[model samples]
Target: MSTTTAPEAAEAPAAPQLSHGLKQRHLSMIALGGVIGAGLFVGSGAGIAVAGPGIILAFVAAGLLVMLIMRMLGEMSAAHPASGSFSVHAEREIGPWAGLTTGWLYWVMIGVAVAVEATAAGAIMHSWVTGVPAFVWVGIFMAFFCATNLTAVKNFGEFEFWFAAIKITAIVAFLTLGVLGVTGVIGHAPGTANLTGRGGFLPHGGDGLITGLLPAVFAYGGLEAVTIAAAESDDPRRNVANAVRTAVWRIAIFYIGTMALAVTLVPWDDPDVVALGPYVTVLQLLNVPGAALAMKIVVLIALLSAMNANIYSASRMVYSLVTRGLGPRALAKVTGGVPRLSVLASCGFGFAAVLAGYIWPDTIFLWLLNSTGVAILVLWLFIGAAQLRMRRRVERENPDLLTVRMWAFPYLTWLAIAAVVALLALMTTSADNRAQLYAAGVLVTALGAVGLWHQRCTAATAATAQEPGRTP
Candidate 1:
């Protein structure tokens, strides 16, 4: 028998196929769970406190912006679906440098997000086991969910489906009961008593409305998970298109409608609305049975679900980066059609996030979170830019695959980019959030510089290899 050498062993390929196990329901639920999160459940209180009833308008504005971003993303994903989502598109349409920066930046954001979500869940779950510490809870939650993600794509999908279903059910129930209570169906006759009773719609005036817009936009952050999850489905193109459409409508309804209901059921001026959380305050006012406890459970579910989704997304993105020659190629190796190494690597950030929070909750952790403050905004801007270029290529190469086209092509695409920039500019005006915006700007600048350096090195290395007399 002939012995194979090291070269031969190095040439052997590992498994690379990703399992397509996500079904229609899985896609639907992932889409739902991605957008509706703890942000909406709890974070909206800040906006409600600031804008009062006008928070509904803020949600509408942010929702529309999100819709535009989704449309641009859907168009690209439909034509060419990739687990990397916008990062892959950026590479093809923009440049290798843009893709590198965007992918790494997005990965960082999600990694941090995973840790934050775990910490939040751990805090809430601390009550169940008095002796066990919060960090241990974070570790346990991260380990268990990471295992599920490492097992099969379908497993992640199923987990997210149930997770999202619970959130949706809670939101729908709250909206229904709140609406009935506000309309006086539960007590008094139908009226706008709670809505205008406080200080009219613009309680704090237009500045409050503007202030509310930023939080509303951030609340829509996890939406890109649907597009990322699309690659694990059999009919990714069709699934993404449908999911995008429905997700848009649901965001508008759940965000705008829920905000409207919340403010209407419970006066926005009420201290409990902000201090106790808008959802809980509204539900308690309606006297829903065990509203506080139920909402607590729901918040935990939402955070954990988001953490699970992020773990899956970040792993896929890293796997895509490796396949594209932008990451450690070892991560590209697939076990059971899952990027197990990437999953482990992505989940590793949980420790870093926890440590940062522990070390300096006010400074270091704040910076880490703030550094990603405008990350979603930056991601959207890049996606819109990618769509502008990719659209022409898709039309020329495979027009038939243009099942999900961006609205108005280059025209609307430019508008979306401009809108995102405007939002960033708007962010700088807010004293509380400006530090985060500036920190994100600095982070983005560094990423761009590093990406440029990497590009130059790659080009130089390629050129040297082409020279017959030059040694690499």
Candidate 2:
């Protein structure tokens, strides 16, 4: 393996490029499934609890924000395709400090996300077969995904393709059932009873709706995974463009549509909505046989699918960072077009998180989860900032590179940034959310300081080497 740093690594002959093993179909399915995760399947119940039928509004708001973010990311990514995605754009258009901060923060966020998904999946399985321990299930899941990601990149794509297909099919079927129940085709239509009877929609008022935004936003976190995968596809530019173009419908159908159906079919205050999850609650309300078992099977698939993709994304992210001379050179080594070392490192962190759960289930484990809870919001800020600068640079230096453009130029870009800032402020105001924002803040600040310091030192070293009297 080559042990070259950033500036030198660019010239290193041994530094291998990632393979274009992903196909358009893989990207298409990934784009569809990226937004539909355990977060939407399981976490949306909390949003409903807070916002009632108004949760639909919260999801729509969050969905629009994510759409804007995706547009900006697609603009930059299609212009300069790379496995690094926004990290590479950040470094070039912003600075090395920005790149390091964005890449490493995302790597940590996604790594923790892997643990989150595994834990959720394991708990679901353990519920079915109580004899097997939850942590044991987590370990099994972690090992399985680690092995999958360590092979050729196509294996990851194929896994995600099928995993996504299963979940998508399940969601479509659920929506179809919801439509039937709502129109009285299958069962008695509640006829707006569920939505209007329960405190008349905005039960908790505007504050509750604002509070609901936190989870609503978090559920949209994984949509960026498609853009990250774009670099490995045969046509990064076209694939990314197509994926972004379809994000609107995907978010509408999967997120906003589901929230609407969930709130319409079942009372928002139903305890089972929170306890049994919204999907199962709706199924049970409609008198579907084996509702719990059916949704549990679907939820398990969603969690496991998300876990696999998170590991793959985290590994590729860190691998991109290391290849640019940001971290350990050994991790940058790509064999068979896969960064196997980075895969292990990502899965290792996830397994460590599992142990943390066992050792300190209450304090330490909660902190670990909270720390990553808001990391996606921070990375979105980076994507928006990078796009703001890169759009102009590309237009001036290489006009044709603007294969996809951010809508409304600087205006919408500014709007996106301001919206993120507003969400962060809202997070600080909530007692439940305050801890998560603070934990994420501490980690991001630490990483930013280190990135800036490293950037300055690298600059000074380069200047010194260029001096006339310097030794060659």
Candidate 3:
């Protein structure tokens, strides 16, 4: 079916105009920094504990998956850039239901991520200044980012660019230090002792490697922020294409390289790997001065960067949904070429989530986190599915739009889908992951049903208006 005349596409009003304020440099930095979230700093301990040195393999696998998903997403976004990104593509290719399901799922995921990132940053700051409360810090950080997002799109882009530059510089420096330490330049090289020893690198065996993949995959969650931001860039196609091309090296150096170094410099099973995190553990081993304080600052910056980016992406996504009639029309309003109302709505939800952590940490907050746990995977599935269908349609109707083509077309697309499905099925075997999958399934199903109902109602209304009128 031609997207130009699809009923689902026609049901929504025309997209609202947004500022093309994001520059090529901003897009590049966002893509580079998006992959290096606080999760890499704090959460990788579990993967290292479980997979040992083989955590490298787990990260590589996850990184490859992200790279593939980004390529597919970039292809679509380059062809037809929109704030909705994959959600818009899904609605055009699959139907209104797919769009609504994926859009809201992604929006909710980022909203929760905003709260999580804010809380993590607050905890770190409170540790530095014991007199100040963590909640107060969270409020301060929240307000600061919110103010940045509420203004022109350029402010948001500028904030993310510098935030990303900090993280990129830190990781590159860390990697350089790690290579030097491993090469016997700075210190005696362990020489595969960490990898060969400690249960011969396999440690807990294949099951451990599989278990490690869970965290490793989740660490790549925010990479899609670049594509979402691409729509507002000065040159959407060129910027998205460049960003997607660089994703390979970014993931290679920032994630895979760092994991290799962490396991190489220090024992993967080191208690401090879990106690102080992989970065701090490796830095302390290398005798870097003030390693602990240094990593704390870097990790704090990471959390803040993620908080800022997720807020921008989530607001744009909700704004896109409203423009498509999937959400409240009021949120579709744009002031100064920025979706001010949608920005507030996104920030408000994140703030409410922070309060939920205080009021009902175990019940409400935990549920919010878990329910959105599998959202990234779900969105990946939607992207794959939409790309498979949209690719064929675009080729038939407008071959010129295939600037950033998916490698190997249907084959790689199918492979990604299968990999995701296999992982989702495997997740059901684990008790904790099973709960998350169940909650996510519930959320997707409810949204899908609502979307379908709305689609049918809109069709009926359009039909009635087209019928012959007795008054006329």
lDDT, candidates in the order shown: 0.85, 0.84, 0.87
Better of 1 and 2 by TM-score: 2
- Give candidate 3 misplaced runs (Cα > 4 Å): 1-16, 470-472
Clashing pairs in 3: none
Tell me, by lDDT, which candidate is best. Answer: 3
Q: How displaced is residue 134 in candidate 3, in Å?
A: 0.9
Best by TM-score: 3
lDDT of 1 by residue, 1-472 (tens): 1111122111123465888999989988998898788888988999999999999999998998898899999998888788888987887777767777898889999988888899999998898777999889988998898889889899999899999999999988988887788767875543677678778989999889989989999898888889988988989999999998889878789889889888877778889877778889877777777888899999999999999899999998888877776778888888888989999888887567877887889998898899997899999999988888878877888799889988877888888899889888888787867998889889889988876776677767778777998776
Candidate 2 lDDT trough over 10 residues, lowest sum: 1-10
TM-score of each: 0.94, 0.96, 0.97
- Please provide, for model 3 over 318-436, each residue's C-alpha lDDT reduced to its tens digit, 9 standing for 90 to 100: 99888888899999888888888999999999999999988999998888888899999999999999999889988998999999999998999999999999889889889999989
lDDT of 2 by residue, 276-343 (tens): 88999998888989988887888888888889888988888888888776788898888888888988
Off by over 4 Å in 1: 1-14, 468-472
Report model 2's TM-score to 2 decimal places: 0.96
Judge candidate 1 at residue 68 and give its lDDT: 88
Task: Please say which candidate is ahead in TM-score: 1 or 3.
Answer: 3
Residue pairs that clash (backbone atoms under 3 angstroms), model 1: none
* Descending-lDDT candidate ranking: 3, 1, 2
